[model samples]
Target: MKNTSSDIEEYLVNVPEERKEAFKKLIETISENLPSGFEQGKSSGMIAWQVPLETYPDGYHCTPGSPLPFLNLASQKNFIALYHMGIYADPELLDWFVSEFPKHSSRKLDMGKSCIRFKKVDDIPYELIGELVQKVSPQQWISLYEKLYKK
Candidate 1:
């Protein structure tokens, strides 16, 4: 479900009790793996880690007043969602993830361009996810963003 909560804590509080621990674990993994200069906040009804607006005031394309989103974790109606911006920005990264995920995970990867859906907590490949999250630092992300879309 789309959360209207303004804070991460508040957002987590609204998650179903049975699913809260998994969500917390996801948050912990994200917190531990993210590179420097990413700030955690609420965006698009999900918990997001982004390049702070102070670092790049141009912010997101859709929401220029908001920070540029890097990763977003959301509890969707049917599954948990992890949006990794690195994969979206770099085609090689997405290809690698698709090729490598099945090698390491028993669960089928449910994904779009960048959104990975987890039907159960066990469906997550924590190590791979962490590695993917760590692939780009804030500065690198900004560079990639500008290179791809700064026209």
Candidate 2:
């Protein structure tokens, strides 16, 4: 099923008010910084920013059934999550991020296959995150996916 911004907002019901505001602010910041042609939408119940299908006929691999760009943002009860499909498909990028922002042995990076989870706004290095986001152009991301997935 297609996800919508309202769905994402509804899922955030359990999030604390303060955290909700912080998450919203972060989302706003990301929205403002995204390159043109990237539209805001929702997928899998998470807020997403992506290039429209008209821009990339192949569609977003992260959400294979959907035709939107695949970048995702979502909130869980404990943390806010950001996902870039390239993280799982691009080892160099993942290695660079892990090395540059080394996590302590005691505290994991709280990452899934592609998602990065932050318990609080302060937990994230905003500048580094911004740099990472900027580095992945829509076309470049598609190329990376093709190189890695061969699809």
Candidate 3:
């Protein structure tokens, strides 16, 4: 499930033609709204934003050598998948997103525990994602991560 490729450009080059622009826009929305201290790179075969090892030396408990993933944006076989760790771990955040989704997009949400799937692709809610990106900062994620997963 993890592509060893470190190059994000190569990852984008392979996204289905129809999904490319929207995918890129989501990336832009996240990058623009992301707070200080999280780094963007390729992780788990997707374009990801994470708290770097420098900021959180413990890394991911599931994969200690890797950065602690906050969000991962991936082009999947069936849909665009956005995996956001905060919303999965934080009840208030999850509720906020579930409530706000309808205000931003008419399509009913297709979501997993932490993964938001945009099967229609064209209807992906970029604004809501931008707001979600701003919801958790690096320190907040690290503190939450330690409490929820590092044990």
Q: Return the top candidate by lDDT.
A: 3
* lDDT by residue (tens digit), candidate 3, 20-86: 9998999999999999999999887889999999988889989978899999999888889999999
Q: Where is model 1 poorest over a 10-residue stretch in terms of lDDT? A: 120-129
In candidate 1, what are the lDDT values of residues 63-89, reduced to their tens digit? 768899899999988888999988988
Query: Which candidate's TM-score is highest?
Result: 3
TM-score of each: 0.95, 0.77, 0.96
| Span of ten consecutive residues with least summed lDDT in model 3 | 1-10
Q: Cα miss at 82, model 1 (Å)? A: 0.3
Give the runs in model 1 whose Cα sits over 4 Å from its true position: none
Tell me the lDDT of candidate 2.
0.69
lDDT by residue for model 2 (1-151), tens: 2224466556456456767776776677777666666777776777888777777776756666565555787776678788877677788888877776654333447788888888756666665566567667777876776776646
**Error in Å for residue 115 of model 2:** 1.1
- TM-score of model 2 vs. true structure: 0.77
> Which scores higher on lDDT, 2 or 3?
3
Error of 1 at 124 (Å): 1.2
RMSD, one per candidate, in order? 1.1, 3.8, 1.4
